[model samples]
Target: MAQQLAQGGLTGAAKLKAVTDLINSLTQDLSTSSLGPRERDAALDELKVYARDPRNADPIFVKEGIETLSKHAFDGSSATTSRNALRCLANCLLVKPSTRNIFVDLGYPEKASIKLTTAGVEDEFLISRIIFLTTYGTSVNLQNLIDQHHLADAILQNLTRHVKLWTGSSGSSFKAASQDPMTDMALTETAKLLFNVTHFCRQKVDSFTPAIALIVTLICQHALPQPKPLDPPLGSLVNALLTLNLASEQGAAALFPKANPAALCERLIQVLDKAVRSYPDRELDTAVLPLITALRKIYELAPAEGVQRVMQAKLLPTTKDRKKVLGKGQSLASLILRHTTNAMAPEFSKAVSHMLFELSDKDATKFVQNVGYGFASGFLFQNNVPVPESVQESFQASEGGRQRAVNAITGQFIDKETAPELPEMTDEEKEREAERLFVLFERLKSTGVMNVENPVARAAREGHLGRDVIDGKDRVEELD
Candidate 1:
């Protein structure tokens, strides 16, 4: 019958309609088919030929044929039939637009996706076809699949499994032209597609609550690769993290409350541990901020201050000699002591203190001189934290005055070598450094520090630190 239609004996439209009617009949009685494996194979061969016919390329025939194929793919009794159905779908999709009247008439959306979703088809062949179409097929089909059906989630799940499989079996000399890279790139493209589609979908809703919820979960799971510096960049992970953080901070209250900060912290730690265990030394230089951010988010969620403190004990670095295989060194303890301390978030005090105590005597002193006062200032100013009156008073009454006095105290203890290096003083270097520091000071000024004079302004007032007087105080203040 299909061959007769292909021969063009009857009017093309009429014959195409007839084929569509037969397909619709097949869709209806598909579950009742008791064809044996051999019979199923013969039936699929016929469908495949019909799908390739030029006359059956009309939109109505294509739609009914794809629907029929999807139904047969889902029928579970015949593997050969399902494979043939997918082959037909792929061949038809690969046809030129002029010849694919069915696709053009149907708006070239992911009709297969809609059919699968509406029909609730979970057959592996249909899934594989969906995956191929989304990864390598056109944007029209992908958008339709994502928008008309909840296909993003399905793609994500499939991509995740694919990643595990490909990465697990991969060997050295990895190239996309090779089996591993090709497979991995295909999976990666799937992930990228899902991300782009989800982003577009997010704009339609007031808040991307549902889309973000899935994105966050996926980000927290895979973006942070295990064993630091493993294969991907940490910056890549930040795209997802920062997006989640910004969304939670902005109007996504449901997202924030629903967001599991603690789980996020744990997952980050797993990646960090892998990185630390893999490349310990260099990580302290670059990994500190991200780790701190993760911890801070977790600390934010702790109900009791004491709980935050305890959580710190669990998450904070304890070892001093952690180094990567390359002999590059990262001191988590040093980082914690240097970056998180008094005057800083109190959740970090205990951890910072313990680590500070472990640094080299000279290095410890230098660390204090550079960031110590900043840390002290944080502790001193925070009403939520307690500082001894003796220390506070000592900080307040010194020669340079309270702020300068604290700086002096920290400066006295710091090792010159370990003290954070000020930028080079060459004219060119100084200018760039000045701009950078101005940005930094502006940030500091905006933190609502009372009695806080801008560092550049204070330097100008003292006639010290640099020869040129700091200009644009108001502009700096405006930025602040």
Candidate 2:
């Protein structure tokens, strides 16, 4: 016969009773100080596992079980115990939103804010997440977090450490490959909390201006690696940027620093390039739009040289690019222009179109000049923008500037491509050509080639040569 329900060790009602009994025993043990540290931690561990399971989750939270978890979550001496306890709490909060009210009533945000002021990487990640959760559906006073706990300053300090670590101002592991995984997680979590606080306290964001520079430096560095559409640090980092004003003077300085503005601008281009190439519209709405919006803001605040890099990297068409259509080429400029017209991603399309207009110096003529009338026209006309009358005249680049016009629909010049067959020459014109061939053969004859024939001499003997010899312009005209 097949094995049936409630037939083996700890099955059905018996197992349920045994688990409840275990929770009862562990709860009573952790509630008291009579148990040794090892015994207490052991009891907390078993109870933590039971709390993770939905069936047994409620039994552990009813009495001293939650208090025990909270007490140990702050245990400074035992790193092992603290991490387990934090994980246990994280699970509880995630599984039951009601647990937030319980944790809030326990007045943990006050303690969390205090610990966050000095928490290390692991503690930072765990505590930041927990407090961030409290931001939702709880009686937690965020204003008190700002005024009393120095929350903004603490986030700024930790973010500054991440920046220093990235920029090599501090820490031995300066590069991403060398960064501690724990530190990376901590930075992401802290940034998420930073977004929450700023989102909740928009009027008080000026307190976070100093943090704007730190985030810029880290983002500029992180973007170089072309991370995933929603990778931790970079993704959270961009969200953090979206909340703060890039127009802040401090943020502007970092984004367009005199030392090397392209360090910021170009790296962001790489990030954007990767985003458009990697994901479709559905994912782009989340993974891509914020980045585009953030980059557009940065560009709006970018300095001349910074704007110059963006133009060169994504707008200006090169001489070699003229032979082919503008957006048809595989260049970055082509890729970006193609997306400017993408219908599926309307917001993305509109954002990019406006950014392109801004980059075009917000003048119709410059827009046509840089991105071409082909790609510029749809956006311009739709917005009731007029194409400058002089756009046609502007298309003629100065001599030695580059190659001239491609198809206007292709954005610029319509090259006069060579014909497949040569045209028939007039008699005089044929004579001029025969004379030039004679000159070439005479030079070859001088070089001691025995078989060389002076076509001019031969043609003259045959009465087929021009009446005059090849010479300068005046004589050549007479010969023709």
At residue 84, give the lDDT of candidate 1: 63
TM-score of predicted structure 1:
0.35
Cα-based lDDT at residue 471, candidate 2: 24
lDDT for each residue of candidate 2 in 1-480, tens digit (9 for 90 to 100): 221333223344554565566556645654464566676567566655655554534554553556657777774457776776787777777767778878888877777787788877788888888888888898988778888888887898889778777777775457653457888888898999999988988887878888877887888765343346457778788889878866877767766777777676666677777777777776666677777777677766766665666645564565556556667777766777788888787787888788788777788887777777778888999999987676655356433665565455555456644445867567788676776776777677677645555546755786645543332111211111
Clash count for each candidate, listed in order shown: 17, 6
What TM-score against the true fold does each predicted structure earn? 0.35, 0.75
For the record, the alpha-carbon RMSD of candidate 1 to the native fold, in angstroms, is: 16.0
Model 1, 126-188: lDDT tens digits are 443444443432334445556666565455454444434434432422233134333434434
Which pairs of residues collide in candidate 2?
A: 405-413, 405-414, 406-412, 406-413, 406-414, 407-413
> Who wins the TM-score comparison?
2
